[model samples]
Target: MADPFTSALVRHVLGRLASEAIEEYGLLRGLKNDLSALENTFKLIQGVLHDAEMKQTKDKRVEEWLKTLKSASLEVENVLDEAKTVAMIKSLAGEMGNKYKRRAFFSYHMNPLMVRFRIAHKVKNMRKKLEVIDANRSRFQLTSNTTSEDSAGIASEISNRETSSLMPKICGRDEEKEKIVDEICNQEIGIGHDGDDVRVYAKWGMGGTGKTTLAQYVYNHEKVKTHFELEFWVYVSAVFDIRRIIKSICGLVDKQLDKMSTDYLLKQLKNKLKGKKYFIVMDDVWIENEHMEKWGELCKALSCGENGSTVGAPLWL
Candidate 1:
């Protein structure tokens, strides 16, 4: 008598095999139907060719009709070849289905004995990786949590932060300024709603539409400057350097040149933006959806005021 577990495994494998066979059979039938259709189309063409001679053709219509019939014949041959391929695939899938069933049955009976061996092997490798990761993480955390022992180092870092805000000078953005200002101030132009909704202004005309300049103008304007509690400007050009972006934002907000690791920068950004109303400027964005996601991550870090709610007001150029 078969063991109960083995019997149950066999039953499950047979059920799956049956299901796969039915699917393959359906596919085979569909392919066979397609082949029949191709055959019928070929027959129809032959009938048409037979009747074409009855019509007296004075011009080159006979030659054209012969050429069309030849083309049709070639098409029918191609259709038959495709149908044959489909049929072969269906047959192969059936054989594979049977093989899978047999393999499953064998594995079900044998796998119990091997499970312990596999687990031991896997656990050995996993433990090694975990140990390495934990060691690295411990070192990183220690470094990150270090106390500032030197006052001069802290002061120098602070001074460096103060001078890093060398914003690119605004140039040739008169038309863009008019458009963006109008969009922001004019309610009819649809910029602000209850001062909560982030009015996204996209300037997607072409390259050199003064997108960056217009963004800078908006960033520095007295109205925008005073309205928001915190402002963050990140240059996310075609090359997506996440570390650089976070560093730039940190420098803008805290005014420092402290070298922050990628992980720490992200954490610091999130902490800094926890409960502040901030406007983040992402300049020179690429024409790809992935760039959008990177921007979204930075936005996620910014504190949007209450309930971490911040509206996405985008001005794209």
Candidate 2:
């Protein structure tokens, strides 16, 4: 039988491939054809995932096939993740090259040519494995009857989890929580050169860490509550839709901003945040290479806040 996490992993990989950053990566590295081939292969596999799950109980061959597909899909996910991380690191290093000469060695080690070649080779191999698995499905008479709505249902159920400002009962994290709270509460408000600048404090680590939990404790602390006039908790998830994020920020203050366009929303947000001390928690943010401009735009919109305004982003690194 297929592992329960297999379906979720497959969905995540598909989502990653569909992301703008990956599309840009493909274009830049001349891997557009390879990426497209992988995408098509995954879609074929996805259509039969449900059918295979149901048939595995009745047929041992189907069970083994699911296992093989699951293993190959996981390897693909790992390679994609590694390539993305390397690409992001290299981009950052390039941006800071003038100031950080020490990053030269890192850049040399992560040569774009080498990275592209490695990713291309792995993608070709993974595609071969996936094609073999997809070809076998025909022998088993697997039909592509799984509707998109079915997949949507599963994805929605998995993505429905959210973050909140309500304090949670916890243990062994008081020290960390106190430190973060102090950082937020003690920043001089309207008193220095960078006083009005929105300071960002991010808890960067792997997923499943206590980052969000700690942020919650700090967000709801008595000090935090009194320091800022408005506080918002936004669950950004994987996709960074600027309009949605602005709508969320405005929605928290009982103002319903229209979703017609991002420009209109940002204008309204600027007015709403003007001269107020606000704290926003952008929880579960997964930023890629393409999100920098969007992030900068959001920050510009938030710049209307008064001194001591801050953003806490607990990134799923």
Instruction: Tell me which residue pairs clash in candidate 2.
Output: none
* Best candidate, TM-score: 2
C-alpha displacement of 231 in model 2, angstroms?
1.0
Q: What tens digits encode model 2's per-residue C-alpha lDDT throughout 1-317? A: 44445554565577677667775453135767777777677776777776777788889998898889889889988888777777677678778875554645446556666667777888889888888988888878876555566443333322444567776787986677787888888666222223336678888876657788888888888898998999998877666768768778877332444425678788888999899989889987864656777887787778788877888888765
Model 2 is weakest, by summed lDDT over 10 consecutive residues, at 189-198
lDDT of 1 by residue, 32-81 (tens): 44333333332222222323333314325543444444443444334333
- Once all C-alphas are superposed, what RMSD does model 1 give against the true structure? 26.8
Off by over 4 Å in 1: 1-179, 182-200, 252-261, 303-317
